[model samples]
Target: AKGRSATIFVYGATGAGKTYTMFGQGEREHQGLIFRAIPEVFDAINAYGEADGHLEVKVSFLEIYNEVVRDLLQENGGGGACRVLEDERRGVVKVANLAEAPVRTPDEAQGYLRAGIRARTVEATAANAQSSRAHAVFTLTVEHVKTQSQGN
Candidate 1:
């Protein structure tokens, strides 16, 4: 697992700690999961980068509100029709210009993650106020150089 690509999904009820378990414990004051994991992931990447190779990581943060996919990173805010473009060969769907940031250190990644999370949309329904009205997806793609010997 040292040099491999993976996709992970954190799904659960509201306030279920889905993000916490996947990422890590949230800040002591804020108590959110993404806050914890961003730094950890960045630290891992930095450590790996210092060794034999480097990791090129791209993060895309998004939110689906009222059955509409919204770009969390959009400067104008989200609340309109949006489209998902697919890469046939790669078998992936992505939102255009959805806050893709390249981060090297855990601290930098943490900052970006915090900013993106803050930009996410939340709503208050009859059942639950201060609830996330949409599904949030944070995708991190990591690419590392591999040698033929290691491929064996």
Candidate 2:
């Protein structure tokens, strides 16, 4: 995967394994990165720094629910929120500051994820009691010093 920037998109109908697959088991011990990818990325960066070298990583989370944007991190003081903001370039949308949760290990990442899942919004719908009616985006920004460069 040299010179490749990975991008993954998980999508499916209700009751599918989209979330479960991404986040692993919902159990506290087995919780995956589905809801905590940003924190996980930070944890990875920290781990890499400790083992290999230093690097900087930033994360952000956003959600669009019923045509409305909600911040999943700022709500309840990092416990979770539905705050929406306007961006001149990105337009109006909901965004979360994942930098607030700095995870240094996989366990810490899992803890944040468990808290996030508990705080996530769920409503009882006609078809499903707990239905997810929004799109959640977890972004990770990785920066490192390049030892070598390719010339055009």
Candidate 3:
């Protein structure tokens, strides 16, 4: 279980709420999973009040278009120019130049998400001009370290 990891893949048929549910369409009341999950996670973590441990949340956003990956949080186009390689020793897949952002609060996370969303591949559509043309992946890295009171 320690070595195993999980991922939440949000997908559905076209016109379904995949985009709507993931990115929150238009208004805040209709916020999507990505938006809603952030604060809730932080609140739950913070509920421990530093007694459980010190937690840090780092985030990253990426998009896969036509099998090519683009780093959403990266300012330069070079971030997209990555080579995929597998680490046989560690049995892990690696993207050479993808970017990961460190975020403390939900607002900071939201800022990264917004910037990532804006960087996504979108084009004019009959339903919405800003329709996402690629599949986007938002990742959060939660690192926890126990305090002296909790552990030696």
lDDT of 1 at 10: 72
- Which residue runs does candidate 1 get wrong by more than 4 Å? 1-3, 13-26, 29-31, 49-53, 76-82, 87-90, 145-152
The TM-score obtained by model 3 is 0.79
Best by lDDT: 3
TM-score of each: 0.66, 0.58, 0.79
Clashes (candidate 1): 0
lDDT of 3 by residue, 60-107 (tens): 888888888888889853255456789899999977777888888999
Q: How accurate is candidate 3 locally (lDDT)?
A: 0.78
lDDT of 3 at 150: 36
Among these predictions, the greatest TM-score belongs to 3
lDDT of 1 by residue, 49-87 (tens): 335545677766778777778776556554354587899
Give the alpha carbon lDDT tens digit for every residue of 10-92 in model 2.
88878776666666665556654454455556555655533333564444455666775555556562334444556879675
Model 1 lowest lDDT segment of ten: 18-27
Cα displacement (Å) at residue 53, model 1? 5.2
Task: Flag clash pairs in model 2.
Answer: 23-32, 23-34, 75-80, 75-81
